[model samples]
Target: MSGLSREKLLGMYQKMVEIRLFEEKVFELYGQNMVPGTIHLYAGEEAVAVGVCSALRKDDYITSTHRGHGHCIAKGADLNRTMAEILGKKDGYCKGKGGSMHIADFNIGMLGATAVVGAGLPIAVGAGLSAKLRKTDQIAVCFFGEGASNQGTFHESLNMSSAWKLPVIFICENNLYAMGTRQSRIMNVENVADRGTGYGIPGVVADGNDVLSVFRVTDEAVGKARNGEGPSLIECKTYRRRGHSRADPAKYRPKQEVEDWLLRDPIKRFKEHLIQEGTLKEAELLATEKETALRIEDAVKFAMESPYPTPEEALEDVYG
Candidate 1:
């Protein structure tokens, strides 16, 4: 809010709201048996997706993880299609097959999300390489969790991106826990950004809960990538407010820790910041919330009215 334009800040605020409300709807719908399959909610980490995507162009590509709804929305995917996808309706982006974990909207630059841990890393690297070869200024971003940093693909992709000076940014959303395992329990490094040094790329850290802070760092990285300066590792330190997946209860997390992070809720903080800065009034924030809720309600209605993919269509999109 300090250096950013009013429009930019407002856009970021709206996106954070959309993600939060969308995920909340998904959680509610899933509980009511309105949606099928498991979902990894992106409630608390809305700032990361909004901030990073704010730094990208329409043509730039992004790869997302299983917890990907935030990424899809921030990158300009249609809310209706995304919601329909989670509901497994025929109107979904993947025609109900990909469900919650594999929603992709290539028209909006989202390559796709993979459920397998760390699988998106190499895919993002490949997209970067293709962009470089095609002589396009388009850059690629990969969003992975702290847990994926330990995977072999992380090292391999980072090393390869640095060696070739590919236009890619490796973003690690370090929400403290990788699924049920805490970061400290599995990794020796204090910061995931430190892993960037091994690949000869600049490693940067930002507060994943702070949208402005994330935008600042990612804007710099995207600028460098556009200028052919190569890849950078950005580690966003944040916390997830829910369990790794639905029905898990997240009892593994400390009650105090959850309460502490909830106090730092990115959407609430951003709304307050907007009001304090006079960019948006308290009443306007409330109105926005109401509007967002209605929009998501419409999405749910649309998904409910839509049909499901027929059995014959199962192998239609499948490729060997």
Candidate 2:
């Protein structure tokens, strides 16, 4: 909200709402046995994706985690195609093969989402290196959870990117739990960003729930990366409202913790902020919500109406 134009602020709000609604709809469809496979919903962490992507250009690259619908939507992927992919329809981004865990739209610079925990780090590093080699200022963003931070790929990618001054931004969506295990139990450090010191890059932390806060930090990081300042480790302290995946009930988490995080729901908080600052009226916000919901519904309709891939189609895109 700080010095942002009215249009940008509204656009951010719309994106956050879109992500939230899309995830919620996916949850509903999955419950109805309409969606195939498991889904990692991005309900509570909408701000992180919208905020970071808002700071990036359309051509700027991003690699996402298994929980990546928010990332795809934020990066400007078409709603119909993304929904179709989740529904396993032929019109999907990956032609229905990738499903929920592996949607990619290169036109929007959404390189892809991989299920492997820390795999995106190296891929993002590769993208940054490509940009550097081509003498372009494009930067790459890698989105991973706290659990992946402990992976070898994390440290190795950071070290390599730092040494080469590749334009990369490593974003750690620390929602406190790596699946069911809490961050405190797995790692000694309180903040994941602290690890940046070891890699010789700036380490920063931001409120993942606060869209403006996230945008500010990411914007600054983007500036640094584009100016050839190398990579940065950004740890956004946030929480996932739902269980780890569709099968997880998240009983491992304390009931009180769930209640507290629900109270801090990113979408609700941003809505209140926008209203309090007079940036948007209540009716306008409601209208945006309604419009977004309708858009998501249309995407679902599109996906439902789409045909599934034929049996032999899977062998078409296969590679060694």
Candidate 3:
């Protein structure tokens, strides 16, 4: 895929598989009431996070949406910590405080995920400004849904980043539905990226179901931003295999739509591609799957065994 090294391609596959398994396990745990708080599963959209983060340097900043587990894993955050965080164990990245929607690891340049609809946009814009002021080649990326596009923060951040030529990439994971609302019912614009034209920045779309396609498009955007070309709007058309959040049921979605997206499952498609290209044997792919299952099991065990944060910790890390 795009002449990427065998290692990198396999790594991408592993990350996607890891996220899928992690989320699947989380889903099961939630059903069992083992996980606290509601969860927004990233099961269907693994390709977007893996593909884009693969193009990013470790030092580059990324702001995540409520559904951010995939982003954290793709950005090299410790899976054990992430899983622990989801389980609300003290061993978690946030000491069991952040839960599933707010996992953040600043060391990896993951600013954190906010459950608020469009809040991360301005934070990412600020990070981009910081990079520009520091005169570094580092860039900031903000991941949001099509629903957030309507927020004033989105427009304002894009305008500011464009005006200042800030090194930021605005990625819209247009998964068709914002919660239960389909994009067509909410926004008039057919393509979200087209809105970027008003800000005088490059607007592009990629196949979110294809990891390689996402990587190729994001690489171009990251390169442009690093070269001081300002912000870009990259819309990755995707679909979420699950409902908006836990217990959503998503009765509004049509059977055919769900079926169509199932056929485009990113992880399955990537595995098939790797085998067809002779890059990996079926056994090798199965081995990766087995390894991922074991890893997830270990993470779950670690989370289950870890203690919860002390009550006093609730008072820490708080602002008046």
Candidate 4:
């Protein structure tokens, strides 16, 4: 909406800062042996999530990747419940069944994230098919990594979505690497967004570090989808500041590249933009940071106090 007013820009900055701080706290907690399982921290590429989700309606469905807590938060999922899910507490969104990879809030339209690379694409397409069949104007968005672009699921899902003209937005969070492999080495194509053209869909590439740019492009695509236009693909060129997963130290990547991306931190860029627009006052920004810290601290306490699921409930969600 007119390149984001001052208040709106401040809100965007706050969300990005919140995501960064949450991930930093998670990293510390995990090191202290407070959390379980492998974790994927979305520390740097926050603008992509905040920008895309801002243009979406509450009822619009979204599928997330392993590095998905940022997306979930951006889509309005409760921070306490998300922290609980990551901590594997019964009070979590999936009652500790989903863990970090599977945390979801159906009420917020986050249709669960998948640990398998590119698997969520088809799921989003299936959701899109249902929306199409039901004649609902809702769109489904899938957040996937650059590594997932090479999978068979990516190809099949895009083909199916193209044939059906489903209301789906395949958002490729091309952060330049797949876990540790370089995207340039794996992908010979000039651009990942161009893949949508082969599927007979529209493709748009936006600067992932620029919140306003991403918001503008996503708004256009999402609006088109809501108006019964087919699907569109958005390739967000972003980067992750930390290791891909908790187990990964990301040694394979060049040191210079890491330093380069760190310089382009999405949160910092958004903060600067807000400041330039006279949106976020220094005092107000500091207060918001304090609030975010308090919320995360309380979430940790809630997760710690919540009960773990009983052993008997393990076989419930599965079918023979």
Best by lDDT: 2
Task: List RMSD in Å for every model shown.
Answer: 0.9, 0.7, 0.8, 1.5
Choose 1 or 2, whichever is better by TM-score: 2
Clashes of each: 0, 0, 0, 0
Which lDDT tens digits does candidate 3 get at residues 1-320?
A: 46999999989999999999999999999999988989999999999999999999999999999999999999999988998999999999999999988999999999999999999999999999999999999999999999999999999999999999999999999999989998899899999999999899889999999999999999999999999988999999999989999889999999998999999999999999999999998899899999999999999999999999999999998799
Candidate 3 residue 230 C-alpha distance from true site, Å: 0.9
- Model 1 CA RMSD to the hidden true structure, in angstroms: 0.9
TM-scores for every predicted model: 0.98, 0.99, 0.99, 0.96
Between prediction 2 and prediction 4, which has the larger TM-score? 2
Candidate ordering by lDDT (highest first): 2, 3, 1, 4
Q: CA lDDT of 222 in candidate 3?
A: 95
Q: What number of backbone clashes does candidate 4 have, counting pairs of residues 3 or more apart or in separate chains?
A: 0
On TM-score, who's better, 3 or 4? 3
> Which ranges in model 3 have alpha carbons more than 4 Å from their true place?
none
Q: What digit string (tens of lDDT, one per residue) describes model 2 on residues 133-232?
A: 9999999999999999999999999999999999999999999999989999989999999999998989999999999999999999999999998898
- Considering only N, C-alpha and C atoms within 3 Å, which residue pairs clash in candidate 4? none
